[model samples]
Target: MTTNTILFDLDGTLLEMQTEPFVKSYLVEVGRHIGDKYDTEKLLKLIWDATKAMIVNQDADKTNEQVFIEYFTANSEWEREEVWPLFDSFYRDVFPTLSHLTYPSPWAKKIVETAKAQGYRVAVATNPVFPREAIFHRLAWIGMSADDFELVTVYEESHFTKPNPGYFAEICQKLGVQPTECIMIGNHMQEDMVASTLGMKTYLVTNWMEDRGEPQYPVDQRGSLEELYQALTERTGVFAQA
Candidate 1:
């Protein structure tokens, strides 16, 4: 299929970062900000566990936010009334400070802009484990706005996370495109490349690849972000059809 749509992963794909350290800082900082009456360690653990719950969630009706908040408040001393403000304030205030841990790719903005200029549809298909506010914050680091892409997936509006075919399917349905008519571009071997199961073409970004020592993944193409930028601009290799 000649794909007209492209899916870009945010974390290590577009916004460069060491995933483990960034996640640690993200959870620890949130704990520090909201652990006034709660145990800091326990609060971090609660967030970590609830995050996993959100990632594996498959409820079509309940958003990931519903699953995360329900699981988080149920296991902790916090009530719904107490949950909203603490987390909301943390995202608004503390989350943006963590941008220092990430290095934005100059090619990321260029690639999306080039794709738009060429009339190819684009979407930020990052794993919706974070709220839209946090996702937008990261997009800002990459010099992108939500208006730049046809769809931007976020926890509040998404039902599934990456590596689950449902997540890719949900995006396809929303964009009114077939899975075969889209390209999944990301750095994670299993999580991002899993979009291939839904018949989407896959591009593995190896510069900051996160394979977790798993068996080799068979993707349609593999390269760095700069190579991807060139592919979009010159219309070569896997992007030749575009």
Candidate 2:
């Protein structure tokens, strides 16, 4: 029998928040900080443009961090070094304050504890878009702390983001586990289900699903955390009879 390792997504999976409201709040606040030079509307558009550029950024010549810095610097009048500190400040202070908009649900916390108790390696496989500080803050909003995870990917440390099979591969490599022994449980069809293509088990957390472009394989899908937790426990031969 294989030892089960559970990989989770952060934003919509563990932490609950309405996407639009959270984005609106984040952009509004970020805009205020940059407004001394750039207009709010323009700043928002620039961010979207930069994000789009990032999605297609596959050049071996530059890393994502470099690409973002280059794009950000090219579009703004601020010096490169100045931009980093400003963005870091916003992420550290203003980002955590957004935690007020998130609510804690018992199921998320319960599942993490159950997985750990069952001797599963529980890692947060959230896309490495934000810094570790931001990731911890969001986890705290859901009543889960860094101590709950065996591994948590942060933007500064990871070179690839999900939907890219390399990201899934890297996680398996780091954990010293085979792809078949791991299970990815996440809300995004494209990001989470990508693991299935690489021979890993996958669970679709439908309650907070995002319609990624498309999924390459069929996966075990569930609508709630309770259902997912039960399925995993049963599969791993760790579920106790009631």
Candidate 3:
């Protein structure tokens, strides 16, 4: 089937940032932001535990944000009422400032625009562990905007996280596209390539590649973001032939 949609992963794929350093910085900044009012270490632990909840989440009724907050409510000193404003403030004022951790991709904008110009539905298919502001700020770092895509997953609405087939399934369901109608593009060998299991075509971006023994899916194409740009704009390779 001809693919009509494209899903791009953020972070290492589009935004140029190593996953480990970026996440460590994020965890530290968030801890320092709200931890002054509470037990800092405990709060950090709570946040991670909540994050893990979102990753393994299976309940369709509960959004990842709800699951994260629920972990805090049930196991921590803070209440939902208290957590929202604190995290919201951090995401708005602090998260955007972390763009220094990620540099812009020279080809990110071109690939996205080429797909859009070709009338393909594009999604910033980043993991939905973070809030909308977090995702938007990261997109801004890569010289794109959340509004540029047909769908941008956020913790407030998403019920699954990366490497889980359910996450891709949820996105497919939301976009009204069959898995065979889309291409999943990213740098991570496992998390991004897992979309292939759902029958979505996979394109593995090599810059800042994360390979942790997830060679299960036979990648349909593999190269740099610039190569992806070529595939779309030049209308060649698996993308054009799909």
TM-score of 1: 0.95
Clashing pairs in 1: none
Task: At residue 31, give the lDDT of candidate 3.
Answer: 86
Off by over 4 Å in 2: 1-3, 59-63, 233-242
- What's model 2's TM-score? 0.86
Candidate 1 local lDDT, 108-148, one digit each (tens): 88888898887789999999999999999999998888998
Model 2 — which ten-residue stretch has the worst lDDT?
233-242
CA lDDT of 19 in candidate 3? 89
lDDT per residue (tens digit) for residues 1-242 in model 3: 89999999998988878989999999899888986687878888988998999899899899998998888789987777877798889998999888888878668888888888998899989999988888988888877888899999899889999989999999999999999999999999889999999899889999888989845677999988888888878777757864
lDDT, residue 38, model 2: 48
Candidate lDDT (C-alpha), each: 0.88, 0.74, 0.88
Candidate 2 local lDDT, residue 111: 86
Model 1 superposed RMSD (Cα): 1.4
